[model samples]
Target: MLRAGDTLVIWRLDRLGRSLKDLIAWVGWLKERKIGLRSLHEAMDTTTPAGKLTFHVFGALAEFERARIRDRTQDGLAAVRARSRKGGRRPVLNVDKHALAVKLYNEREMPIVKICRTMELSKPTLYSYVRAANGVTDGPPAT
Candidate 1:
């Protein structure tokens, strides 16, 4: 632990944290309290003016690396978007089945449950078709 007037000396900036962002924030907090940071291997010391420049350079490098990564990722996604047959499962209920379901639902006196069984359609799918055939666009069916 470091007191207000003490310094935190380490072998490398990496020893402070795994990433440059963490190191920058920690160093900023330490700087706020007039607490110094010294990295023995890099000859950088926050107690001196020149050492602050060294960390500024490191921060700039980290920002550049971050921007480069962002640009590359965006480019990769654009390439994927350009590929043929954009992904999603094919429609489960087709035209012929939809027509048959609509007919059974509208025509005979058969129960709705029986119609679903005859068409081999789920209750929800049958309801959706009935709603569409009657031109009801929003919300649950009337009954």
Candidate 2:
């Protein structure tokens, strides 16, 4: 239950919910209870008709912004795919380097730290290459 003068605080509207239907339901519930909802960053309040209208406008704007972001992300991914470019961080170890690193670790009795230092890689990166060479489908286990 809510009452007048009670402040309902939210970090952001996005944190409240992702969809317009959810937002409307929450706002409607607050309105029914006479609760004043406020978003710290967005400076929205639902205690007045003007405030309620502003919240609706804000929700619409947020939805539009989310759609635009999703569109741009898809477009970027498509462009990269068209160009045959891989997304995400490039692997630090190529096949030859990975093979050599693994051999040195397994056959030459090289320490993991030494191998990582020689290959100018972090421990995790060196371990991943070693694991791959060992026919382990999964990369280095999560820390």
Candidate 3:
């Protein structure tokens, strides 16, 4: 909606966006089109150098805050990695359980239903594990 000589008026700086960065970006876009901004509450007019400088300062502060948040998030993730095996939900099948299931399916000729009952797993879950162990990646055989 911006055009040369046009001005975007707002009740307050916050009316522009939720974040200072967004407001700054909007102001930059307006400036690119030779448009200006006016905030009633702030009584600031981006048609002048002083108003533009004020916006620039807000934008710089927003960028600094964003960097700090990113750094803190990285530190938090590192801390979590230091304490746990992995961050997600526990696996449905672990190494020992997979081994036992494979042994029953291959060596003992145990029925899938029996394996499911013994392992406290559903039939589909047992079949999936057995199929994976048997290298049957394509669905059950046509036979």
Best by TM-score: 2
lDDT of 1 by residue, 1-143 (tens): 67788998888665565446667778878877778988887778888879898876765665666678778977876776788534444554689878877887788678889987877777898888889888987521122
The 10-residue segment of model 1 with minimum total lDDT is 84-93
Q: 1 or 2, which is superior by TM-score?
A: 2
lDDT of 3 by residue, 46-74 (tens): 99989888766655665666778878978
Q: lDDT for every model?
A: 0.74, 0.76, 0.73
Which one is best on lDDT? 2
**Per-prediction CA RMSD (Å):** 18.7, 11.4, 16.7
Summing lDDT over every window of 10 consecutive residues in candidate 2, give the lowest-scoring window.
134-143
- Model 1: residue 14 alpha-carbon error in angstroms: 1.5
Candidate 1's clash total is: 0
Mark the regions of model 2 whose C-alpha exceeds 4 Å error after superposition. 1-6, 32-34, 85-143
Q: Which candidate would rank higher by TM-score, 2 or 3?
A: 2
TM-score for all models, in order of appearance = 0.40, 0.49, 0.40
- C-alpha positional error of residue 57 in candidate 2 after TM-score superposition, expressed in Å: 1.2
TM-score of structure candidate 1: 0.40
